[model samples]
Target: MTDLRQLRHFVAVAEHGHFARAAAAINLSQPALSRSIQALEANLGCNLFDRGARNITLTAHGQLVLEHARRLLAGSRALHNAVSQLGNLQAGELRLGAGPYPAARLIPIALGELARRYPKVRVQLLIEDWASLRRRLLNENIELFVADCRELRDDPLLSVEPLRVRPMLFFCRPGHPLLALAEPSAADIAAYSLAATQLPEDGARRLQETLGREPLPDIQCDNFMVLKELVRQSDVISFAPEDVLTSALVGGELATLPPREVLPRKGSAYGLVSRAGHSLSPAAQALRALIFAGDVVAQ
Candidate 1:
């Protein structure tokens, strides 16, 4: 088989139309470079060049081989770049999984920052429950997950970094019964049905643990936009991330409970967590570094 180095030498010589100059450009002696091209031609069973005592000219076969050789060299350089830049935070897809509301905000912000710096890299997003997200990551379905750290509970299969705290806000249609109250207690609001994401296990447990009872939602789904829509149409209430609710609040489609001193600014502490011990692709790691470097700060 024609070796990559051999093809490289042949293509360089073809482009420069002179072996001596090609060898000089590549920091090799002309004879050594000639030998490499000769080997490549011999392996391919074709004469790639017609050499005079002083100058080398392309054979008809040289034109065809030169085309393929240039392509091979270009691809080889691309392969090298793809591998090298992985560490430089420059390229590759970041498979991301996240909770809907947080994902709505964090994913957009992080991806925008990633795009500005590494525009060539792509991002694939999926919103799912923590259990499903964890499962997908273990199966190599995703590279990173923006998850609520509190839900992770000491699993050795993951690595996490805290991003920001999210505070939960209750939402209801304007003039809903509980909204009229000066300060409604959990029970007062509890009288009305709860409309929550009802995420599998993890989110469910956190919700019940907070309210001291399993919340029977008036509606449930994994979509944040749908959850907001439910609150806008009826008296349904959902505790959602502040960022996701921004447009709704501004449009008079929803409202918040006064900030709870007990809840964090981020009612839930969400972070970027990797699956177990898997090392990230160079591009993914680069994006992670920029994300943590405050480059993607809460935009």
Candidate 2:
């Protein structure tokens, strides 16, 4: 029978590309590691490596077996972690992928509560633009996701649930002309230096039509903090979730563009999304519940 220990030795050698290195990695003597590999080859009735004096190369059969062995080892590890330990949230890694907007507030608040509860669970957050975040979800790099509904992408293996909605508002630095001056048309907004999301033309066509011009934001960015800071430092104007900059707005950080009767931009809804087919772990489920349940770390 092909022993699991021999297979581990074979995998270690294949991965390191050198028997001496692999032996050192696994804390086994080089000759013992070689013997383990030979035993494995005998069990399978085939030599696994072509040791060409300078380096080692795997035969076709060896390549195939190595791939399967790695997969089996990974599966075994996952199974052991899942079954052997239950509800010990702090022991494993939790990866959450979200666009910049939702991550701005959601990540800090959500993670704060998670830290208080599962202090040992390692949390990693990946922030990407709408386009990239969608790709990562499809690639299965992240288990949980959240983004604005306007850019809500649907894949057969993805499920989305509507979360909190924040109103979008246009604002500029405190003394910008847009505030004290008469209500200007979308054409007027285009005339000034504007900072906003780098949305594709087709996706934001209606917004463009309302603005009566191609959406040409002079300072295009996806980070709310950076965008808000630029507005504070410069006379730049921006349109974003009203709540995203609530602290900035209240603390003399930004001033809103007067509500316009001529052109009404509607509020946008942000949704909490996850990979459709994969089951979420308890830690992920708990965080998701807190997200929709409006549980946030009190500011």
Candidate 3:
């Protein structure tokens, strides 16, 4: 079979119409150029050129081959260019997942930056609880996810890169009865309706231990903003990372319940989670960099 190198040599000799000039143009010796064309002709079972006293011309078979060769070479160049674009993050798709918190806090910032820098890159973001996100990742529905990693850290099938820890707090509307207490105990806070997004297994266990019962949300929502609005309108108490409530806290739309020994001070441990041995695509790597950098900026 004829190879690209041979076809290239054949095309060069055809264009230049002389063995010596074609060899010089292609940076090959005359003998090497002649040999490559000869091999191509032998492989194709047809003569490609007519040799004259001072010049060479293409035979009918050579004309057909030249047309096909140019098309093949053009297609080869296009394939290389597409691969280069993907490597540079200039063109590709990023399928990513995020738990409620990071979807609300971290992902938007990173996605904004990614869009600004690489407008050609398409993104599909799935916002779900950690367990669902983990399932999606393992099932190959997404490249990676950002979520609470407490349960996932010990999994032998996963690789986790922890993000900075934030503080968790229960908050309600400013004049909610709990804030009137100097320090409300978990029982005191639990008396009222509790609202929250889905919790990780460890988080639920801690909540159960603290409240002395199976923790159930009166209003469970994956969207924190909706939960925040609910908290503002009613006496319901909700817990979230401190940063998620920063605007509400600053604007006096909400106030945190005073600290109690029973409540966990540490927030959810968010991280980047992927299959242990799987490699991330270039687009995923670029987005991951922006995510880490956005975390720094948040701090």
The most accurate candidate by lDDT is: 3
* lDDT tens digits, residue span 1-299, model 2: 98678888998899899999999999999999988888888889987899988789999999899877876665554454345336667466666777767777766777787888888777778877766776666655556777765556455656778765567788888988767667766777666787876664454676666666664566778887788888878878877766577887889878888664332356545677776766776677777977765523322
**CA displacement after TM-score superposition, residue 112 of candidate 3 (Å):** 0.9
| Alpha-carbon shift of residue 48 in model 3 (angstroms) | 52
Tell me the deviation in Å of residue 114 in model 1. 1.2
Which lDDT tens digits does candidate 3 get at residues 115-214?
Answer: 9998888889998988898886765667789988888889998989999888887889988988788888878877888888887766777787777666
Candidate 3 segments whose C-alpha is farther than 4 A from its true place: 1-87
lDDT values, one for every candidate: 0.71, 0.72, 0.83
Off by over 4 Å in 2: 1-85, 200-203, 260-265, 295-299
Better of 1 and 2 by TM-score: 2
- lDDT for each residue of candidate 1 in 1-299, tens digit (9 for 90 to 100): 87888887887898888988999999999889978887887788988889888888899999888776765665564455457565555554556788776666767776787788778777788998666787767655577787666667477988877776655777787768776777877666666667776454555655566555665555777788787778778877777777677887899878775434322133666778786676777666766776666524653
RMSD of candidates 1 onward, in order = 14.9, 6.3, 17.1
The Cα error of candidate 2 at residue 269, in Å, is 2.7
